[model samples]
Target: MQIILNGAATEVADALTMAELIEQLKLGGRRLAVEVNAELVPRSRFSEHRLAPQDQVEIIHAVGGG
Candidate 1:
């Protein structure tokens, strides 16, 4: 399926959930926040949130600064 990820066009396998997508993208253990279709998806609900075609996915990773 095709989805917009971080403002870029991305194509991923079918029937992927947020959790699966994270793992698929190797984002495990990273401090990040996810927004789908202008809605914030809680970390706990990652496994439950299924992605659909043309969904907007924004993953913001934390950065350290002094």
Candidate 2:
């Protein structure tokens, strides 16, 4: 399946869940925010949030600043 990830077109496996994508990105231990098709997806729901083809996904990582 194809998806728009962080403003770029990318292909992912069929029936891939948000949690799996996060693991694939190697961000399992990082603080981040995810938005799908302009809708925010809570972290608690990542495991159940399945990604669809052509879905627009935005992943923003949190950075600590002084």
The TM-score leader among the candidates is 2
Give one digit per residue, the lDDT tens place, for model 1 in 9-52: 99998878999999989998898899999999999999999999
lDDT of 2 by residue, 1-66 (tens): 999999999999998999999999999989999999999999999999999999999999999999
Clashing pairs in 2: none
Which 10 consecutive residues of model 2 have the lowest summed lDDT?
A: 24-33
lDDT of 1: 0.93
- Pairs of residues clashing in candidate 1: none
Local error of candidate 1 at 48, Å?
1.0
Give me candidate 2's TM-score against the actual structure. 0.97
Candidate 2: C-alpha lDDT:
0.97
